[model samples]
Each structure stands twice: as structure tokens, then as C-alpha cells.
Target: MDSAKAEGFAESLVDLINKGALAVMISIGHQTGLFDRMAELKKFTSQSLADYSGLNERYVREWLKAMAAGKIIEWSSEPAEFYFPSEHAAFLTRKHGSDNMALYTQYIQVLASVEQSILSCFYQGGGVPYSAYERFHEVMAEDSRQTILAPLLDQILPLIPDLTQKLATGIEVMDIGCGRGKSMIKLAENFPNSRFMGIDLCAEPLESAREEVRRKNLTNIQFKQADLTAFRPAGKFELITAFDAVHDQARPDLVLRTVYESLNDEGHFLMQDIDGSEHLEKNLEHPFSPLLYTISTMHCMSVSLAQGGLGLGTLWGVEMANRMLREAGFTQIRENRLPHDPMNCYFIVRK
Candidate 1:
């Protein structure tokens, strides 16, 4: 090996190792509400921050130092002050709500928890079940709360012009794989005239959705624990939505066809999933490619393979998605990318 090239590789390895450790620290900060507490205080010493957050001071100090080293927060030597700048606070704290990165960082620990199962699949050629992922529904719901529900009215729904108005005037809508029913609930609450039904294979999330509906007193929305591939509605719907949900299904192609059959003549379907390239070489250039593929291997692909499914995984690119939509009898398909969300591809399809 070239000496210089070898040195560069070593440096890159160090950087990645540091980043991995820092990611766990970031997750810890997010979970413990340390980031939020620091944002509220603006600037504080380790002891003060620990007292404010109800955490141990020594651990807090080490975490603060890590944050400073990671360039996530500002550190001062003279007065030993740690500061969360407003700019950093915006992305790091829950104050920015759905726009925060801390919410996504929580996935690091969750995915890592199943490393053993993922390894077993590598050797045994079998896959982990959905239940293998503990807290998956909860984390997924929190993720939806941040990425989808929190911005639904202002950002996501408005992507289709006049679509909101159609819902406002009363229309039948269905959401497939509607984990915890965050998007549907939001839509139902915002448009009481519209009727919404959410379906999922998992009972846990559906139960949570029903409980939330009762709490919200929403008459326009309902949740059912039904397999998407086998589900048939009494009547056709005017609109359908799937948010980061399609790739995980055991029979995603069948699910697409079912959605096509279940919609009225002019009905539209909106799907949001990982933005990826069908070509692996092209995907290698993507910023989130490593994480995406890792997620697929560890969770998305594994769960589907466990069921003897197609295992499309999280990185099913628009190229493949478009072909599938066309195959499912969707004549009009548009691929869109939002400025606010870089992680997903938005597919607007019409029958």
C-alpha cells in the first residue's frame, strides 16, 4: 500500500470510530433530555447542567466534554462554561420540534440492539421477525411525530395542490401500514369532513392508535389491525397514503396492487420512502447510503426475509418504485423531493 494512502485510511478510520461513539453520546443526550435542559439554560457548568437535568454531574461533565469535542456545543476555558448556541440548539433540541436531528439519532441505539440477530441472519440465511425490534412502534411513532405528523398540514400534505381542499370537502381516505396512525389522526382532526381508516399488520401500533383516537375524541378516524396484502375495503377510497412504510411489507407488490384496486377512478396515492438509487454504484455516492443499507440489512430487509418476502428493504429507489407503480396500473406517477426532507422520496400516483 502507498504510505500516504494508508495514512489517510487510518485517519478516516479514526474519524468514523469517533463519530460512532459520538452518535451514542448524542442519543443519550437526546433521551435523557440533557440537550433540552441545556437549551433552556443557554449556558451552564457541568454541575449546574446535571442539577438542572437531574443527572449525575460527573457523567454530565464527560458528556459535555464529548459534545464540545464533537463541535456540537461551545466550551470556554476561563470560566469553564458550556454553551448551546441558538443555531446549534435549533437542530439539537426539541424546541425546533420535528426538524430536530436528535429524534433520528435515537435509531442508532435501537438498530444496534439487534446486532446479534442480524449476524445470525448472515450465517443462517433466515431473518429476524418484526417483534425482534423492541420499541420499534414507539420509536417509529416518535419518528412520524417528528418527520410526518409535525409537518403534515404545512409541509407534507400541501405537496399536492388542492388535495387538502378535497379532504376538507369530505372524502374517503385510507393509509396503509399506518403505524400508530399519526398521519391519519392528524388528517382526521384537521378535516372532520373527511373519513380516514388506517390499517396495519401489527396489533401494538393499532392499539396505540385506537387509544390516541379515544383521547382525541376523533369520530372521523378509525384504526384496524389487518394485513395490507389481504385487506379489502367495503368501498373505494378517494385518497391513500403510505409514509416510509411500503418497503417493509412481506408482499409490497401485492400491497400496491391492492391499493390500486381499492381506490376510486380518480383517487391519488401518496407514498414517502427512502430516497435511493436503484444502481448500487450511484447509491455509493449518496450521503445517507451507508446508514440506509445498514438499516436494510439489520432491520428492513431482514424482517421481510423472515417472512419469505421480496425483501426490497429501505433503499428501494425511485427507479424501481416507478416501475412497480406502473406495473400496478398507476398511469400518472410523479417523483418529488422536498427541500425540508432529504431522506425520503415522495411519490404522487394517480390511477
Candidate 2:
């Protein structure tokens, strides 16, 4: 091996390990509200922060040391005070919504919990089921509410012209893989004239969705637990949406075909999915390829394989997605990118 190349790789590995540890600490900080408490205070001692957040002081101090070492927070040795800069807090605090990336760090621990099962899948050629990962839907619901629901009304739905007006006038709408039904509920509340249905394979999130609907007294929305691969709706929809969901399906191709069949003649299908390439070399320069591929292996691809279906994975790419949409009988397809969301591309298709 080239000595320089080996040394470079070794350094990279060290950095990776450090970042991994930092990720776990960041998750803890976010979950414990330490970050939020720190954001509120200009400067604080670890004990003070723990007291403010109602967490144990010892654990908070240890976590703060890691954050300081990770360069996530500023430290003063003389006073033993830590400062979480407003800039860093912008991306870590829950108040920041989709910009709060600390919410995503939780996935590192979640995925680690399934490493053994994933390793077994590597050896045995089958896949780990969704039931293997605990708190997945809970995490995904928070992610969706921030990323999808946060922008659905302004950025996402506007991708199709006059779509918001159509929704206002009462059009049939359905969301596939609508985890927790947050997006559908949001739309249903905004457009009382329109009816909404959210379908997912998991019953747990659907139950949560139903509870929210009841709590909100939403009359225009409903949730159903159904396998989308064999999905058949009683009535066609004027608008169908699948947000960051299609790739995880056991039969993405069949589901896309079903979406086509379930749409009215004048209906539109909006899909939000990862952006990359069918060709591996083409994705080499993509910034988030490493994280996206890791998530695909640990969750997206594996879940599909559990159902003995096509493991298209997360980086299914624009070329493959467009080709598949055309194959699904969509002749008019327009791909749009949102400035805020760099990880996914939005597809607007008409029957």
C-alpha cells in the first residue's frame, strides 16, 4: 500500500470515529433539552445548565465536555463556563424546525441498535424487518413534520400550478406512506372543502394519526393501514403524494403503477425522493452520498428486502426515477428541487 494514501485513510477513519461519538452526544443533548436550555442562556456552567434543564449534573458535565471537544460549544478554562453560540443553536434547537439537524443524530443510535441484525442480514442475504427498529416511526414523524409539513403549503404543493386553489375548491387527495398522517392532517385543516386519506403499512403511526385527527376534530381526513404494493383505492384521487416514501416500499415499481391507476384523468402525483444517479460514478461528487447510502443499507433497502421485494435503495437517482415514472404510464413529469431541502427532489406528474 502507498504509505501516504494509507496515512490519509487512517486520519479519515479517526475523524469518522470522532464524528460518530459526537453524533451520539448531540442526540443526548437534543433529547434532554440541554441544547435548548443552553441556547436560552448566554453562558453557563454544566451544573447550571443541568439544573435549568432538569437533568443530572454529572451527565450534563460529561456531555458538555464532549461538546466542547467537538467544537460544538465554546469553553473558558478560567471560569469553567460553556457557551453554545447562537449560530450552532440555530441548527440544533427544536425551535429551528427542519433546520434542527440534531433531531437527525438520533438515527445514529437507532441504526446502531440494529447493527447486529444488519450484520446477520449481510451474512444470510435476507433483510431486517421494520419491527426491528424501535422509535423509527416516532423519529420519522418528527422529521416529516419539519421537512415535509413545514413546506407542503408553500414550497411543495406550489410545484404544480394552481394546486393550492384546487385543494381549496375540494379535490380528492391521498398520501401514500403518510407516517403519522401529519401532512394530510395539515392539508385537511387548511382545506376544509377537500377530503384527504393517508395510507401506510404500519398501524402504529396510523393510530397516532387517527388520534390527532380526533383531537383536532378534523372531519375531512382519514387514515388506513394497507400494503401499497397491492393497494387498490375505492375512488380515484385528484392529487396523490408520496413524500420521501416510495423508495422504502417493498414494491416501488408496482406502487408507482398503482398510483397511476388510482389517479383521476386530470389528477397529479407529487413525489419527494432522494436525488442521485442510477450510475454509481455519477453520484461520487454528491455531498450527502455517504450518509444517504448508510441509511439505505441500515433501513430503507433492508426493509424492502424483508418483504422479498426490489431493494431499490435510497439513491435510486433521477434517471431511474424518471424512467420508472414513465414506465408507470406518466407521460408528463417535471422534477423540481427545493432550496431548503437538498437531499430530495420533487416530482410532479400528470396522468
Q: Return the TM-score for each candidate structure.
A: 0.96, 0.98
What RMSD, rounded to one decimal, does every model reach? 1.4, 1.0
Clashing pairs in 2: none
What tens digits encode model 1's per-residue C-alpha lDDT throughout 1-351?
699999999999999999999899998998899999999999999999999999999999999999999999999999989999999889888888766888777788788888898888888887888777877888889888888877788887787889889998999999999989999998999999999999988888999999999999999998888877678888999899999889888888989999899989988899998899778998988999999988899888988888888898888788888888889989998888887778998898998
Best by TM-score: 2
lDDT of 2 by residue, 1-351 (tens): 799999999999999999999999999988888888999986999888888888888988999999999999999989889998999999999878779999999988778878999999998987888878978999898889888989989888889999999999999999999989889999999999999999999888898999999999999998989999887999999999998899989998999999999999999999999988877799899998889899999999999999898988988889989989999999999989898898899999997
- Give the lDDT of residue 260 in candidate 1: 94
How does residue 141 of candidate 1 score in lDDT? 92
Residue 9 of candidate 1: its Cα lDDT?
97
Once superposed on the true structure, which residue ranges of model 2 sit more than 4 Å away at CA? none
Candidate 2 residue 240 C-alpha distance from true site, Å: 0.3
TM-score of candidate 2 against the unseen true structure: 0.98
